[model samples]
Target: MKKVRIFLVLAITSLIAFTSCNQSKPVKTIENLKAGIIGETTASKKYEAFAQKAKEEGHDAIAMLFSAASNAEAVHAANHTKVLESLGEKMDDFTPEFEVKTTAENLQAAIEGESYEVATMYPQFLADAKAEKVQKAEQSFTWALDTEKKHNDFYSNALSALNAESESGLPTGYAVCPVCGNTYDMANVDDKCAFCMTDKSKFINFD
Candidate 1:
């Protein structure tokens, strides 16, 4: 009976140690998640403002595209929030700040923002999450990175069209995946997002 009690105590201590280790917060990963949330949230609001400016300029395609990107950013922010929540932390509420310009200028600005995120910000965040073994945070950063690539491409093309005064550069229909924020051209959209496999039915469609 004494031996049995000793063994049980040893097992309990091991369990407690394991639990404490597992519950330890990943500090860098948590900071990355919070920063990602702020960036995405600000991007969302910036796009919204840009969309309104596009509409005012009678640029339907630009307006629709900005709206789609705005929605995608919101989805990305929500995904980051979910990961943070899983870590038993909540983001402090903050307002987004951005300046709205002409459609051409806005497209250029959008391109720059997406380019930085795809090439620098998201890549670093994903790397940190992977290093910390924060699975959910890694997944969120991966999705944002992939989706930002699409946004970058779209914004680049739009800016080029604006520079050339080509109507062909303006897209009329777009869809953003609710699961991963992958952007799709509704012209020949697949049933599922290639990056995240989110169904078209679950996509947020815009025109």
Candidate 2:
């Protein structure tokens, strides 16, 4: 009987230890979530400043798109903050980057930087959120992806317009399908380039 008691006690103790060890630390509090949202908000603001600079530098369309994207980011940030608040957390104030020079070089750099974040970092973030099963995060990520895709299209179109307006007038005569790389003058342009037909908006003014 004594041996049985000792064995049962040992088993209980082991179970307690195992349970304690396996218990997850509380999920990060919502305050931490707010901080993350603030960070993204800051980034979006930076993009907005970049866009403003681009506009000043004659990239009007790009600037407009960037501004729209910035607003989108702000919406996302607000949503995150709201979620955190719902969880009873206070958010910290965020100050975004503001240094911007209205020069072609600066504009190009800003566009490229934003592109990298959207194309690379954002996608990875989405994947991570999916792995973690954060439904809200996934939704936010999808919104961001869609916005970035639009931004990409805007930038491409703006660049094309800029090039066309440059000293060398739109390359004369040779017809180039904006939808597809397929080059054929007015005579061609059947239905639409297979790739471009998928989404006509993605087509830049190639000719």
TM-score of each: 0.90, 0.54
lDDT of 1: 0.89
Model 2 per-residue lDDT at 194: 39
TM-score of model 2 relative to the true fold? 0.54
Cα lDDT of model 2 by residue, 1-207, tens digit? 999999999999999999998864214434335544765587578767877676567655555545555555665576666656655556766566556664445446556755875678667766766665666655555555555554455455556666566623222222222322322222333455433342433333322
Score residue 11 of candidate 1 by CA lDDT.
100
Per-residue lDDT tens digits for candidate 1, residues 44-149, read 9999999999899987888889999999999999999999999999999898888887899889889889989988998999888888899999888999999899
